[model samples]
Target: MSSFSADTPHSSSVMGRIFIYGILLIVAGYFLLPLLVMVFTSVKSMEEIRTGSLISIPTSITFDAWSKAWSSACTGVECSGLSGYFWNSVWLVTPTVSISTFLGALNGYVLTKWNFKGADVFFSMLLIGCFIPFQVILLPMARTLGFLGLAGTTTGLIMVHIIYGLAFTTLFFRNFYVSIPNELVRAAQIDGAGFFMIFWKIMLPLSIPIIVVSVIWQFTQIWNDFLFGVVFSAGESQPITVALNNLVNTSTGVKEYNVDMAAAIIAALPTLFVYVVAGKYFVRGLTAGAVKG
Candidate 1:
């Protein structure tokens, strides 16, 4: 048989694969259509947004809505805008992510290496806290904070986030450490390394992936949080998510749909940006550690 005869089937297979990819691309576009529409509308003038079909390209692109969303948009008497909430979210998310990730690492380390009589019970209780809805805890948490005189304060909100972020962060890191070889820890101990020393030097280095996972998860949760932020951090301390809600939820003379959409996009941008930057690390981290447990 000629070599050309064999090459013909190979060419056909390649063409079939290409056809499959083309179909998948079309399906992906279908799923992304709404997001595309939102982006287009966010940049369009209000008149263009009102007059044109949602999917149509704008005749005149304007940054007015974005500008309004950032700095001058009115939410009640406060027209200083979403930037205030943006900075507040940044402050909240940073400490929340750091503290939660650190505590999760500590929890995982303790769970994996140290066994006590009631360790399982303690861990179970913590895990149970995860299953309970935040709404259930919200009232009690509020009352407790108020009793402590931390209500409607930034510190109170941070404490609430650290509490909430604990469940998932601890779970993720514990599962990760479960996959790690016990022999490695024993070997480190034989070298006369203490618990904190071993964790800081040996285990923590290997835990970069899990830390990334915890940080990303906590960051998104805290940034997008509205209920906790609303209940705990009112006024100037409210996170961007709360501001976005107030912006879109108000009864102005006329509702600014374009501005609302723009504000929604703006409020989401930080978490979106974080994911875009660290998403690869998240996948890599989970895959590296998830199989061990």
Candidate 2:
């Protein structure tokens, strides 16, 4: 095929392109305005903030808000800051994403490659799980957590997220795996590979794109979750989301808007970093998986 198709006309005139780009730029700026305001507010002193408009540029930049937000901001009477909660979320997200992705991969592999008497029914149940409202499960989940002695603990929170997120992870990988040809599995079996061996040597190696999708998806959900974090965990065990809430909404006589903004940005930094680095792959992976299933 020729690099340029002479028979095909260009989709739009140059002016049309300019109009499209102009609209896109306007929309982008509209969405990014909050972030710009946040950055400006976080850097400006309270005096400047009081005197200046919300969107005005700071004449003097200071990171004191960022420092205080990270370390000594008062959350009610306790002033431990979000640093501890940040690390708690890190530990929580790491294992949850890891375990959920692995198990979801296994579920996908089995449901797609190995036919069982009730596989369709089982997968449908999982699909149903994806649509179940988070609110509906709260009471039941809390009761279950209490029964298991994991209530008000980070470990309990991890289990809750993993269970809730499993359906999504499984659906992603299953859709992706259905696109993979079953012949690959048969050939490996013909070569005397066992189930675990086939999964380890073949399916796993082929699962990179879906794995990235699952990780990014699960990471964002678990890291940003406030309802679960607040409901299931206590003081030291709370995730950054819960702590950020405390920092922003406490009954301090003087509201530290700058500190609140910085704490918000800090809490958001990990998800932002993840999306910035791997975001392009996220959509590509979804499309790759969506091709067959």
Top-scoring candidate (lDDT): 2
TM-score for predicted model 1 compared with the true structure: 0.87
| lDDT, model 1 | 0.82
Candidate 1: minimum summed lDDT over ten consecutive residues — where? Answer: 284-293
Q: How far out, in Å, is residue 81 in model 2?
A: 1.2
Q: Write down the lDDT of every candidate, Cα atoms only.
A: 0.82, 0.89
Candidate 1's C-alpha runs over 4 A off are 1-27, 281-293
Cα error, residue 99 of model 2, in Å, equals 0.2
Per-residue C-alpha lDDT of model 2 across residues 1-293, encoded as one tens digit per residue = 33456587544667877998999999999999999999999999999999999999899999999999999998767797789989999999999999999999999999999978999899989888877678898988889989999999989999998988888888888888898999999999999999999999999999998898889888888898999998889888989998899888998778989999999999999989988899886666445434433
Output candidate 2 Cα RMSD: 3.0
lDDT of candidate 2 at residue 49, scale 0 to 100: 94
lDDT (10s digit) by residue, model 1, range 1-293: 33355735543466777998899999999998977887888888878877899899878888888898889888766887799888988888888889988998999889988766887788778887766778888899999999999988888999999988787788888888888998988998999989899899988999887788888777877888888987777788788888888888877767777788888888878877987899886665445333432
| The best candidate in terms of TM-score | 2
Error of 1 at 12 (Å): 9.6
